[model samples]
Target: MAMFRIFLGAVFAAIAIYTIITGTSHGWNLVPVFFGDMAAMNWPGQFNFDFFTFLLLSGLWLAWRHHFTPAGLLLGIIGVFGGMLFLSAYLLVASIRAKGDIAEIMLGRARASAIGKQ
Candidate 1:
């Protein structure tokens, strides 16, 4: 799972870089073309990328630090699977920020299993 996450993150980062670079070349309204309405058009509001990115990364971080359960798991899964072909760069940063929480959780589980054997 971790390996998968890392790979996905790398891919996402690439896309984000591409977007940052090419995004302005095309009309800002051109919208990205990808699987999940990658280029969907919408009126900018609080829901724009600036806000969305912050919320998503923050949520991912929180999800990792704490037990986000069904919803968090769903978000991670969606991010890993659904997000790969789209804006990967943003997800990459999010995954990087999330690494510590993920590591801590995995370590805790490892210790639990190890102690349980004794």
Candidate 2:
């Protein structure tokens, strides 16, 4: 599990980096285009909304799991703006930190819920 996490994380981080580099070609003008895409009111618009919903969930999870720390907030913002590229990599790191302990990974940094067990 640890190895898988590391491997997947590396892949995601690399992909995200590549995406960032590629996106630079578009410059900042896409900010308005982003809103326009969301406002299209067609299948593509629906898809955009679907992705936004996922982004919201990702941000919520990050904030919830990281004890609402600054790092958590920052990552949440990144997840919102950077999308799955940031999220997959973040999950990879978290999974690696869990170190094959499913409970720790699922429960975030607080394993109190799994304490006092055999």
Candidate 3:
């Protein structure tokens, strides 16, 4: 759990720094560049497609984790668009809130509590 927290922190920091640097240089207009790569149908495009699928899965998991409530749906959208920016921080916080409980970390509070009762 400690290692996982550390890893999430490192991922958040690294991605934050990279985003700042890239945004400063490119002015944050990422949608076009992101899709443009896919349109070109090359290696970067292939990688982008793969990455997009992962984002979709991440979003879906987040929604499912919260049982697809309104807030869960909102989180799912944000997870897709915000990507690691949202996820790393979210996981870091969730890890802290879960207090080393892997089930709680993955399942959210209510579900985790229900499982615990079982």
Candidate 4:
């Protein structure tokens, strides 16, 4: 599990680097596209909303794990400005913190049940 997390972290880090270079070169015009591009609105708008929902869910999960202040705020920043690159990286680190405990990795300590999937 640790090895897998490390691998994911490395991959996400690489993706983040690529995104940085590409987005910088392209000026990262998400604001205009998100607000004014009506002709190209359908897919982009839906994707944006869905991705934002994931970001909120990720933040909520982090807060549930007792990282309310910093983690939740950082999740929003990274989600809105950085994208999946940071979230994947965050999840990788979180998996390492779980320390080979699949249950802990899959379900946060506060939510993991001792009995079954009930």
Best lDDT goes to which candidate?
Answer: 3
lDDT of 3 by residue, 1-118 (tens): 8898899899989999999999999899999999999999999999999999999999998999889999999999999999998999989898898888899889999889998999
Q: Best-fitting candidate, measured by TM-score?
A: 3
Cα TM-score per model: 0.30, 0.74, 0.94, 0.64
RMSD, one per candidate, in order:
9.9, 2.9, 1.1, 3.9
Per-residue CA lDDT of model 4 for 1-118, tens digit only, reads 7578777878897897887898898878767765554346687777777776776676666555554567656665555555567667766766777776777765666556543467
lDDT of 2 by residue, 1-118 (tens): 8577777778787887776776797665655766678898877778888888998888877777778899988877888886777777777777767766667765675653547363
Clashing pairs in 2: none
Name the TM-score of candidate 3. 0.94
Q: Ten-residue segment with the worst summed lDDT in candidate 4?
A: 108-117
List the lowest-lDDT window of 10 residues for candidate 1.
30-39
Q: Which segments of model 3 are wrong by more than 4 Å?
A: none
Which residue pairs in candidate 1 have backbone atoms (N, alpha carbon, C) closer than 3 angstroms, thus clashing?
A: 12-88, 12-89, 13-88, 13-89, 32-38, 32-39
| lDDT score for residue 52 of model 3 | 100
What are the Cα lDDT values of the candidates?
0.52, 0.74, 0.93, 0.67
Ranking by TM-score: 3, 2, 4, 1
Query: Model 2 compared with the native: what TM-score?
Result: 0.74
Over 4 Å off, model 1 = 31-118
